[model samples]
Target: MGIRSVLSKPLAKWVVERQREWMYRPAEAQQRWMQRLIKGGQNTVFGRDHRLTDVRTVEEFRQAVPVRDYEDLKPYIEQILNGDSDVLWKGKPLYLAKTSGTTSGTKYIPITRDSIPNHIDSARDALLNYIHETGNGAFLDGKLIFLSGSPELDQKAGIHVGRLSGIANHHVPGYLRTNQLPSYETNVIDDWETKLERIIDETIDQPMSLISGIPPWVQMYFDRIQERTGKKIKDVFPDFSVFVYGGVNFEPYRAKLFDSIGKRIDSIETYPASEGFIAFQDSQTEEGLLMLLDSGIFFEFIAADEYFSDNPRRLTIDEVELNKNYAVIINNNAGLWGYSIGDTVKFVSRDPYRLLVTGRIKHFISAFGEHVIGEEVEKALTDAMSKHPETEVVEFTVAPMVSPAEGLPYHEWLVEFATPPHNPAQFARDVDTRLTQLNVYYDDLITGSILQPLRLTSLPRGAFQQYMKSLGKLGGQNKVPRLSNDRKIADGLMGVVSGK
Candidate 1:
């Protein structure tokens, strides 16, 4: 074995042991971090304005600061952008993570010096945890490719500004730099198609062992590889054992991805955002991700059902219950106060606070009071596909068709199929049945005849990709929403179909 492979076991063991110190003591670690954040904020403008210095408990902190989205916090962000120090955090932000915003256009999230480790180390810890559990560190000796945004960055107001993936490129540890694939020149290409082609050319001949990206984009890479070499990914890169992915749930794409690889390998799911690295899969046997309690972010939850209600109860870590969906609110060391990143999660195990990302607060279908979520739609489709083993899905989205040319309005499933189902009508009915079982409100609406049974629209290949390209969000952290209450996406898909 190589020196790095031999040493990985001991290093992973040490990291796992240190992690246990904070992982098991959830309440204590959260309380301590909350106090530290409060103390750090006391000297900043945001802290003084919100009376944070006098806050001694989580309750006081909550009372002092209201939960705010990007729009609500823009004034403070504007001040920071104009070269002001101590406006939000204690000092100027180390970097600004630029991400796409639905209503706000582009959002610049502060990455303070104190908060960078949370983003960097959590990813490292996730890999180490996998090694410690499986005793398979040989992948460390081979090439690893992270299919992400360009590493090149621009400066705004003296702070480096770029996508989170790009900013993270500057912090990759020295030890693994040699094994990381795609030369810097290839990484800086702005056009995703060009970048993808370059990446395939660079890595196809290498002894690749690990690959990481959002599922759809990674699927595209795999597809291109097969097209070029007429071989499955496993044949081209036999040592490719670990697949690390994040940004979206992998269930819907799992069957197709595995089929593309032609074998089953270890995969890690991560819950990361521009705001923070919240959770990661710690155990191969576990169903949910282990939430990071001491990652410089103090978390609060509001029940998903009550999220739209006035005076929603924001509960701390100790107050959360298992299997109940709650919108996540975070107060982190990066100067974000009571920030809502729009994700909802459900705890599966409270012993170590492992949770599943249920859905986004705004990404849902409640057109007829049938409030269907991402989790429900994904699970419904997954269950239905289980029976149709020959069918393979490429991409899909759900939107309400309130005013169809014929019949009662219904939920429309726009799917791009790699292999069409043998009985498409039966497949749609199966999916509808599963969805109705998962969501009582949806079931009621269907039974009462308020809405017709859901309809399936088989989209032509690359239809969703064309829609994303039309919106100038073709790649790099952009994902199709699982479902939307409005028909914007449905109409857009129609446009793409007609244009084709």
Candidate 2:
């Protein structure tokens, strides 16, 4: 380990030790602020009539913040866009983080200056937890590859958050900014493809230790490395320590990432968004993710079993149930009083607030916890397909069947062709193998004969994207959604994938 690597643990210890200062200090002070924030959230987010603000104890924080769906936050989002600063954070949000939603349209979430440290802290917790879990303290010394929105700003506000990929160009630390794709405090990605290519080329030669970012783009760069170098990524950047991915599931494609790479490393889940970096994995060996920034943002949990119920109880951080899935609610500094990012997560513990991200409430397969997530399925499918000759896939989506056939509960896939030999049957077998290899539950269900076999289909060029574009969607914040809870989505995908 290098000098920095050896000091990685020390640096993390310093940060966590200082969390009290950045967040809250003194037990009484912490308790006082907690109560105040809870009351503030209940009255401001839940509405003035909510009885939650008056309730004491940590349970109040849980019960007051109802598990909200994304659609419920449109008006609040509009408030942020129009320059109203009355919601979550304390100061003027440094800049907005662009992202996409269930559909193709964009979502512009705010990131206040105070919240940036929280992101760093949450990320640091993840890094430190890895060190503790794997006994690899020098994990950060290796080249850290962050595949994020390009360093090109969309140049307009309210254009939706995903389009704001360029914002990171300015928000990133100054030391790294100079080595960045474009110069400081400036939004410039000279040529989208060329810039991405340059990033891949530059990153390929480095000692990439810890990789972090959105999984899709991570897979994109991995494919590029293989195509340009005529070898699997293991041959190029073999020293990868751990993959730190949030904003998506890593289960579907764990085969391609964990097993496909040359090194054996950990995969840490994070609960970061354009909105805020809320939670992270705290322990290296623990099954659930640790939440470091609970103080950065007030949290709430609603039992999945109670989602549609009239008296569904939304509990606070301390009242969260272990191992069972629940929808999350948040009141952060971004002016989103009580907002739900539409993600479904389950708490593993709360001593430090760790969680397991099950799936998106609206996006997951309700049938048999097929819980088909983007990161997992994406990595799985990509790894499976890469096993073939001279080929790599750019994108894919999985849609579950609405109508079951004779004890079969299959999920149909829509794959975008990257090369020839696109035989649907072979691809199906490949994908099925991936499901069994990477996803434990998927393998169990398949072995137990619970679900139907997976089906594969290729879409015509510009079919689903065109549909998105036609709807005035299609941007960074929004990806072409692959899985759906809505039954109608299957027919739409079937028609698009078949080019019918």
Candidate 3:
């Protein structure tokens, strides 16, 4: 038997045991985690203010603490930044993850020592579980390339600050580091173009078996590797067997990515964010990712329809039902209270809970009351692009055109295509038809003549990448918002195209 198979057999069993325990007793597990979190922080400022010491039950906890976004916690976070300890957690955060903010310039999310294990352990568990389910552990015998951001960190008030990818890379297991690609010096390079070029030059001939990263950046790497080697990824690395991806939905990029790889391979999706590592694909047969119950995060669900209401009903893991879209709220070991992370998801299974991310709560368009969302637009585009087998969508974004002075309101799509469709107008019509079918409100608006069909503007090649570069958000966890209520991003995209 192969050494990898023998080594992985025991790990697979352990992972399965842990997974089953959580699946069978999720409520019990969650209850324990919540109690631990509250007890650990009972003496902190946030805890005492929210009556954490007196709160013994979920009901009491809910009644005492209110749902909050980043703004609500900014003051405490600021206190932490200014060298205060025990303001939110029991001690000062070991580091902070700096990410793009929705309402502000940048957001610094706390990462405590207690929370660090959740990130590392959960990431390890994902791979172990995938091996358990698929019996595909041979990849462990070869090098694994992580297309990640620079690991060079900055200091703020004695706490390290950097992208989550960089922070997580720092915590990669020592044994795995032996087989990981891209030297530390290469990884710490700040410029993406320079870093990518160095990475391609360094690892183009290595016997790589696994590749992991966000879809967009990974796609770029795949393109570069193919261009350099004049071969498909599978041809270059015959044992290339797995792809681990997160940070965005993979539906739109799936076909193109597989085409570049030149064969079907095992894929695992993870729902990880700057806030927390939420879920990962556990069972290969299932459609949705299995929610990580043992992780330090206590989860709460608010129905999407009621999220903006004055008092939205919050349901625990025990009470949430199947197939309902819910805005995810989390209270985690990282010292985030009842925080709304702005993500919306829908349950695809109930027994061993699993869910698919539907959209972002704030990323939607309702300028003319059509109430279109990210999922609707992505699904519409996927369906539209499916009709034309010869073409593929590289990157795109949609926004509402609410120019009353010019004409009636319509949707504008700025698309950058690697391979343009034969008929852009017909492609636009197909997208509109799919949107009309998916969203009844959008259908009504179109039929009622209140809104015209969504217009498609085929952007010059590399327009989206140029726009991202212009914003200094060119790579590493930065994705263009797919749907926006206002035309600010749309206008910016047009400006980029015009400049080109």
Index of the highest-TM-score prediction:
1
Q: What's the C-alpha lDDT at position 153 in model 1?
A: 86
Model 2: per-residue Cα lDDT over 149-268, one tens digit each: 545444333332323335543455543333333222212343334545777756778777777666655665676677788876667777776787776666544545543464566777
Least well predicted 10-residue stretch by lDDT in candidate 3: 1-10
Model 1 Cα lDDT, one tens digit per residue, 1-500? 77777888999999999989988899999999899999999989899999888999878988999988999999999999999999888999999999988899899999999999999999998999999999989999999999888889888889999999988888888888989988899989988888899999999999999999999999999999999999999999999999999999898899899999999999999988999999999999988999999999999999999988989999999999999999999989999989999999999998889999988999999988988999999999999999898888989999998888988999999999998899999999999999999999999999999899989999998898889888877777789999988988888988999994
User: What local lDDT score does residue 396 receive in model 2, on the 0 to 100 scale?
Assistant: 63
User: Model 3 off-target regions past 4 Å?
Assistant: 1-5, 404-407
Which has the better TM-score: candidate 1, or candidate 2? Answer: 1
The segments of candidate 1 whose C-alpha lies over 4 angstroms from its true place after superposition are none
- Candidate 3 has an lDDT of 0.87
> Which order, best to worst by lDDT?
1, 3, 2
The TM-scores of all predictions, comma-separated, are 0.99, 0.71, 0.97
lDDT of each: 0.92, 0.60, 0.87
How much does candidate 3 score in TM-score? 0.97
Error of 2 at 44 (Å): 8.2
Using lDDT as the measure, name the better of candidate 1 and candidate 2: 1
